[model samples]
Target chain A: MVKSKSWTMVKHFEGLPKLEDFKLEEKELPPLKDGELLLESVFLSVDPYMRPYSKRMMKPGDVMIGSQVARVVESKNPAFEVGTYHVTNVGWTTHFISDGAGFQSLPKEWPENLPRSLAVGAAGMPGYTAYFGLLEICNPKEGEVVLVNCAAGAVGSLVGQIAKIKGCKVVGSAGSDDKVTYLKEIGFDEAFNYKTVNSLEEALKNASPEGYDCYFENVGGNYADVALQQMKQFGRISVCGAISLYNDSVPATGPYIQTYMLFKQLRMEGFLVTRWMQRYPEAQKHLLKWIAEGKLKYHEHVTNGFENMPAGFIGMLTGENIGKAVIKV
Target chain B: MVKSKSWTMVKHFEGLPKLEDFKLEEKELPPLKDGELLLESVFLSVDPYMRPYSKRMMKPGDVMIGSQVARVVESKNPAFEVGTYHVTNVGWTTHFISDGAGFQSLPKEWPENLPRSLAVGAAGMPGYTAYFGLLEICNPKEGEVVLVNCAAGAVGSLVGQIAKIKGCKVVGSAGSDDKVTYLKEIGFDEAFNYKTVNSLEEALKNASPEGYDCYFENVGGNYADVALQQMKQFGRISVCGAISLYNDSVPATGPYIQTYMLFKQLRMEGFLVTRWMQRYPEAQKHLLKWIAEGKLKYHEHVTNGFENMPAGFIGMLTGENIGKAVIKV
Candidate 1:
């Protein structure tokens, strides 16, 4: 028998989730059954989707839903051998048990130079999301201008870099000056602190005088409305996340975009990373090659200790962290 | 030399367009040069796009921009012989001299049974808008549910019928009970008067218990926001127009759709009919076949005389026309 610690939802989040909304509890696991494997969580991921999705899909007293990179401690399943790393949605847990179903084993030849924590960060779901959303949804062509909101965060950072790699002029908006600087350092053609800008429209117009050909939407609301107006004819928008509205106590409202969308012939598509589940390995391989070739870079804002998961999650929602927000147990 | 009477924009539209905003002026035509043809306007189109686009694209002294089906009275060009009809964006003109630069000749073999006015209506831009917007953008599969707003209008009416032809259940919303009846008579699976519905969401839920797989948005604003919430996972939206906000005195605003779109993994694309210009003849052939086989039907609300053009335009904007609104000259 092994003792495992986990965070459980004690109450449904009303607006911004508080630490009291979750309860850290302990459970004693019985011996694993024949196809089961015991997992020890190495790093847990906290993302924007968890906030709104919890209110919609989760019930009180349920194990909080999240993804993590874990090591196989004991395995009866040959597919998930002991000492191999795997990514699983085992929530905010220090340990878990899985039957190898819904578990993705890390590539056997994962470059030793890269951090294993990337299984939950870049080179993982966030990386794959930026890959497919930009390449597939936006289908950006070389010499086109691409704009990303919430840049310096996991997905947005990767989106800008990937657009650059594809020969696009990349512009990004971040919440802080440090983030703006970081984005510029990471090869964004232009980076602005959205919070300090007098007008988002002015900032965007100044950044890309010709207008954007592709928009990677992460921070929705008024920002999205402004961005929509600045899009060139036949532009494409990938609606990945709406972090600005995830914790809204009131229903979110913004300037109607139909008129602009219609005249410009814009295509705005909303998507989840899971839509490309079948092609995960393909994306993973390309992302790995990009990283190894020095064409891609990744950052992780990691908080140590399992007990600090709630704080880490709250900080991420408030834009307190740059890059992928993760908890190292 | 011949005198041609034309409507010219005297002032930009303030709220809703007024008759005095345009000046009916007569101009003496110059002699046709080689490759030029003399055109006599037969049918002029009055569409929702004219209202907003006029203000955006037209200068105060420019002719009111519009498309018209014209008879080639005298042809210096071999391609456009006398008595042949063609569609040209010659504005609100009773006669014009065109060099055939932007003119599309009507199909060489005219269906004697179908009205020639259709060359500017159903068989024209509006019809093709519905065809490509639904089939290409929404891509409705068999057994799916489709919903169209402004359902009795030209594009929306065609959208519902096309969805039905594709083996999808069709639900529609129109402004009046008569329009609803017209939609049902045209083979819509379900139709509703949006004004009478206590709750649009409830109306949608009752109409499509399984939720919609595709949404053809012709009316935007509160209706679009409500329809978005009723969409099933992985639904597609084809945004053709937004007549609801065309004459808005204030900027239009609606509920933020990013959260719903993200969770449902929905795709909403806005398009102009011109996007399918390269494949126009292909779509026109399919539409003509559907009409000839009686699988597709068309209705036109025609206002007589060229002078009634403004009234036709105003009436259409106010939802007075049941189908494609046009003016017979």
Candidate 2:
């Protein structure tokens, strides 16, 4: 028998999540059945998506939903070998018994020196999100300008870098000066501290005088309203996340944007990374190769210990982390 | 010399346009030069686009821009013979000399029994706007549910009807009970008066228990905010117009909709009909055929005389017209 510890939501989040709202629970698992495997979480990811998704998908006392990099400790399946690392979405659990279903091993060409936590970060969901959201949706062309918000976050960081790799001028906005520096270090052409800016409109205008061809939207609200006004004709907006509005109990109201959209002939689309699940391998292959070539740089904000999962989640939602927020167990 | 009488904006409209904002000016035209033709306006169109466009495109002294079906009274251009009718965008003018640069003649197969005013109504810009906005942007698949607001107006009525023709279940919302009746008369699967509905959400849900797949958005504001919530996953919104928001001196405030759009994976695009100008003939061909086959029905709210041009325009913007609003000059 194996003892597994997990975090469960005591109640649905009212606004921002609180540490008291999470309860630690433990259970002793029965012996693995045929073809089942025992796995222990190595690195657990706490993304911005969990905040709003929790309200919609989870009830009180439900285990916090998330993805983690896990190691197979014991296996009864013929195809499985103990000690192999894999990425799985088994929520915020320390140890889990699985039937070896929905477990994705790291890419075959993954560099041995690189951390496997990347399976839930750089070369994982966030990477795939930046890949398709920018390339497929925004479709930035060479010499064109691309704008991204949440510049230091997992997806937004990759989005800006990828836009650079595609020969497009990239402008990014983040909450802090440190994040602004990190953005510049990762090859963003222009970076701004949105919190310190006198005017967001002026900041955006000063960054790109001509106007943006593509906007990778992560923080929606007043930011989106202002950014939309600065889009060139036929600009495409790929909305991957709206971290700014995730904690609002009631939606924040802003200026109606239909007029801007109509006159500019803009296209705005919202998508989850899973929309292109079948193409994950293709995205992972590119992400791994780019990282190996030093073309794609990654950063992880790891919170030590599984006991700090709720704090890690809350911190990420509050924009405390500069990159992918993960718990090292 | 032919005398041309045109309506000019006396001043920029502060809110909704009034008669005092217009000034009728008359000028005598010189004889037509080589390749030029003299035409008299037969039927001038008064559309919702003029309201918003007037603010963006016209100055205080500029003529009110619009399209009209004109009779070629005299011709120096051999290509355009006298006594023939052509569609030209010459603003709100009764008589003008054209260089035949932007004149479009009626389709060759136009039925003799059908009124030529249809050139600017059912078979004209409104028709093309509906065809491409719905077909190209919404791209409704067979048996899918389509939701169209402003379902009795020029472009929207055609959108709902076209969705029906494509074998989709069409739900429509209009301002008045009579407009709702007109929607049902035109083969809409479900029609409701948005003004009379107790709750717009319930009305939409009752109209179609399953959510909408293709949303032809003409009326923006609260309607869009509510409709967006009820969209099925992967819903495509074709934003042809925003008549509801056009009259606002300052933009109206509304709930930020990025969350609903994100989880639903909805795509919302705003367009001007002119974007598909290259494919106008393709749309006109289908529209003309549909009208001839009695598959498409059309209604005109004819405002008599050139003198009522401003009133006709204001009335159309206020949603007084059930279908295409045109002035007989």
**Highest lDDT model number:** 2
Q: What is the TM-score of chain B alone in each candidate?
A: 0.97, 0.98
Question: Each prediction's Cα lDDT score?
Answer: 0.90, 0.92
- Evaluated against the true structure, the overall lDDT of model 2 is 0.92
Best by TM-score: 2
Query: TM-score of each candidate?
Result: 0.97, 0.98
Give the B-chain TM-score of model 1. 0.97
**Model 2 clash pairs?**
none
Tens-digit lDDT string for candidate 1 (A1-329)? 89999898998988889989989999999899998989999999998889988988889988889999999999998877799999998788888888978788898999999999888777999999999999999999999999999899989999999999999999999999999988988899999999999999999999999999999999889889899989999999999999989888887887788888888989888999888999999989888898889888888899999999999999999898889999999
Q: Where is model 2 chain A poorest over a 10-residue stretch in terms of lDDT? A: A101-110
Enumerate clash totals for all models, in the order shown: 0, 0
Evaluated on CA atoms against the true complex, candidate 2 attains a DockQ of 0.88
Q: Give me the candidate number with maximum DockQ.
A: 2
**How displaced is residue B24 in candidate 2, in Å?**
1.6
- DockQ of every predicted complex: 0.86, 0.88
lDDT score, candidate 1, position B171: 97
